[model samples]
Target: MNVTTGLFYVFSAVLLFAAFRVITARNPVHAALYLVLTFFQAAMIWMLLKAEFLSITLVLVYVGAVMVLFLFVVMMMDINVENLRVGFWKHFPLAAIVGVVIALEMAAVLMGGFRVVDDPNAVAAAAEANNAKELGKLLFTQYLVQLEVAAAILLVAMIAAIALTLRARKDSKYVSPGDQVRVRSADRMTVVKMDATQAAVAPVAEVSEPKA
Candidate 1:
């Protein structure tokens, strides 16, 4: 096989392994780490396919930001693995069925006999400008509303996740922004004034110098 094909196979193998580990790992942190590896491999594959914009975005956004956030959240959260695994066996059959269905769907897609044919005209057109620039222009002009909607949905999902993971402990202290904004100096501190009296001082005891 050619070098490109060999590297593709290698990346694909690692990607599959990392993806499998992401699902099967017992620890959430480990799963997140594996997911990061999966993202990296996918990004590399994209790079190989000359999709530099998507590859860089996948690395920067997902691997750098999202996966890091996932790792931190997974690490910080108190996840009871034993409790979570309690019903795994009970749901195994359903999970297996779903997995099989997905596998069959993928197989159908693979069997569709898709081929990539390089068009010289398209390549010549693309050579005039960078793909990222073209993609940006298209997204901003043609898909602006869809893009904004997607961003809004992502924002909502982020807020929901934060709300869900938030735990209110009895000992936990929370400061309200509204209360802070409304706070007055009188509420936080007391200013007391005392009158000063004339001092009657006779406390100093003077000692005579000892004879050398």
Candidate 2:
């Protein structure tokens, strides 16, 4: 009916289509791309809901970083499409049922239309307020220890990933930092000091020609 409602419907439609494609697409790369589209649509919806901080974070973290990583991983992976599709028809009914259930649940939730207007002025004031700053304050004050723990966990995970990547491989050559730091020119190379003398030529023996 209204412009906001129209935009919501449009974004919702595109989001649903993209989400469906993410599962149905044969190619993993295409699926990842579709998932990116889904994330973008969800971010748009968050923006419309006036959750600017969440919307921007969703776009930056998920669309920019996570989806890019997913695309890279999907593209790099050697997937056998035929093997993947082998059980598609066999599993289609169950997948369709689950999908239908999720759709119904979402439809039920969205039946309560958008625009919560308990107080328009309050909503406008809240919208004008700095949500990112408020969120940061809450994180630092209310859930500081939890936030720190999460950060520590993420750091550990990152370290574990790097450690796994640095594991020794028989086929791969890795330069050790200590070895590089301790390397000497003398150990790496030896300059030969040979004189540039002309090579000696042997005298040719002249054979006496026999009378033919």
Candidate 3:
């Protein structure tokens, strides 16, 4: 086999292994780390495909930023692995069926993609072209509506997350900026004035001698 094909097989093998470990790892942090490995492997495969921009973006965005955040969150969370596994066996059958169906669907799509023939000249031209510029052109022209829709969905999701996080809770305390800005000193403190009173003095009883 050629060097490039051999490298592709090696990367794909590692990627699949890492992806499996991502789901099967007992510790959340370990699972996240495995996922990061999967991303790196996928990025390497993209590099072999000559999509340098996509490969670097996959590394920078997912491996560097997203996976780091995921690791931090996983590490910080107090996850009870045993408790999480309690229902795993109970739900395994249904989950397996769904997973199989999804895998079949993906296989069909990939098989179709593999059957498509590409022109060598066009592939060479595309390889020589600026990846980011071409991607931008496609996003703005052919996929403009789809891109805008995706952005709008992301915006809505962000707003929804903020709303959920900031929602008032009876068990939690929060302050309103408007209330703080409009607060008056008089409302916060009150002083009562009273005349000073002298200290009470105890009366002294004259010592009665034994009357003797």
Candidate 4:
């Protein structure tokens, strides 16, 4: 009906399309990029909804940092596309049904439940005044448990990534920085100062050759 409504629909369409492509896309890199697009669209929608703190945070953290790292890893990894697609046929029906059910549920929950308000924010600087401080307070107070859960999830992801990339090679050596930092040259090398005194006592031996 108005600009906000129009923008909402546009952002919604982009988010939906990108989310769909995230699962359906064959390339892992493409999937990551689609996911980035989805995050961006959601950020925009959130901004329109006056959730500037969350919107900016989503852009800065997820789209900027996390997704960039994901894209880098996906692009560098040796992912087998053909092998990945092998079970696509077998999984498609279940996946599609699950996707449709989720979509329907979300639609049912959102469609008639939303009420548009006439509040256009009392002050333009109100969001800026409260942005980071409010978010930090809320995150550290009300949503602390959620924040911890997210951290735990990220830690698990990091562990999974490490496990995926871990390899042992017979020819290669690995050392921890902490271990290296604690090591001393005396532990690794022998230093003999017996130098000059030992040198003076050593005499040249006469060489003897045997007939071949």
Candidate 5:
């Protein structure tokens, strides 16, 4: 009925549509673009919830940086789409079941959240306070260990991903910085001493004045 509620419904619909497209789109680049749209819609919803910091962060970090990198990677990689879809039908049932379970869990959590009542004064205080400042306080104070653990886990995951994807190819050329730093000019170039040889002269038969 209200403009805010109308906007929320519109954004939620777009977010759901974009999210579906992200998973179902055939082209990886198109999927990534759809995911970016999904993030943007989610960010808009967060803005409507008055979480400005989260909204901006989602836009800047996910849409601006992460999605751009993902798009570039998808574009650059030689992915076989047909090969990827080979077992789609075989996996569809299990995937659908898992998706349904997750959706149910999320719905339960959201329903619980809706049922919980918040103090009006506390809500007003929270709304008045700086979002980023309050978030930082909570992160550093109560959830510091958890935050550190999450960061460590993310770092480990990044390292593992790099390790798994990295391959030593025999055909690919790579220069070792240590070897380069330790290289010597003498090792790089060699001068061979050799005797200078004269050019060979071929004997020519003299033509006797064109046989008058």
Candidate 6:
């Protein structure tokens, strides 16, 4: 009917399609690409809803950095696709049951929810101000500890990932950058003074050549 509603439905459809493809696609790289698409669609929807901070964060953090890294990691991994899909049919019933349970739980929770009245004036007011400022206030004032905890968890996870990936292989020829940086010219090159003495001396010519 309205432009916003039309855009919402279009974005929602694309988001759903991308999400489905992420789960159904056999190729891991394709799945990651679809997931990036999903994040982009979700970010657009959030932008439409006036959550600019969250929308930008979604696009920048998830689609830009995280998904790109995930795609690289997925591409690098030696995964066996045939073995991964070995029992899809066997797990169908169980998967369906879990899906149904989640749907029912969401339904039950939503059914108990109270709907807000449409405020035309509030919409105009919201348009005049940035939502991110309010969100920042709420985050810093009310949810600082929770946000800190989440950040701390993320930091720890990052450190753990780096630690897990790093290995000191004795067989591998690796150079320590710190050690390399500390090296002086003497460590890399040697100056032999005997080389100057060994340099060919111009043979003295006869008096005739000197006169010429």
TM-score for each predicted model, relative to the true structure: 0.70, 0.77, 0.72, 0.62, 0.74, 0.75
lDDT of 2 at 10: 100
Worst 10 residues of 4 by lDDT: 119-128
Model 6 worst lDDT run, 10 consecutive residues? 191-200
Name the regions of candidate 6 deviating beyond 4 angstroms.
107-114, 118-127, 174-212
Which candidate gets the maximum TM-score versus the true structure? 2
The parts of candidate 2 lying over 4 Å away from their true place are 102-121, 183-212
Residue 63 lDDT in candidate 6: 83
For residues 104-197, what per-residue lDDT tens digits would candidate 1 score against the true structure?
Answer: 9999998887666499887687667677988999999999999999999999999999999998989988999999999998899988898768
- The candidate that wins on lDDT is 5
Instruction: TM-score for candidate 4, please give it.
Output: 0.62
C-alpha positional error of residue 123 in candidate 6 after TM-score superposition, expressed in Å? 5.1
Residue-level lDDT of model 5, residues 1-212, one tens digit each, is 99999999999999999988877788888899999999999999999988999999999999899999988888999999988778777987898899999999999989877644478897788668888898999999999999999999999999999999999999999999999999999999999998869877889998777665
- Model 6, 1-212: lDDT tens digits are 99988999999999999988887889988888899889989998998888889999999899889888988888888999989888887997898799889989999998888566499897678679868898899999999999999999999999999999898989899889999999998889887675464768899987755563
Model 2, poorest ten-residue lDDT window? Answer: 111-120
Cα RMSDs, all models = 4.9, 5.3, 5.9, 7.9, 4.5, 5.2
Clashing pairs in 4: none
For each of the candidates, give the backbone clash count.
0, 0, 0, 0, 0, 0
Residue pairs with backbone overlap in model 6:
none
lDDT by residue (156-209, candidate 4, tens digit) is 999999998898888998888999999998899997775554445667899999
Query: For candidate 2, lDDT tens digit of each residue in 98-206?
Result: 9899989998899877656799899888878887889999999999999999999999999999998976779997888999999998999998999869978989999
Q: Please list all clashing residue pairs in model 1, or write none if there are none.
A: none
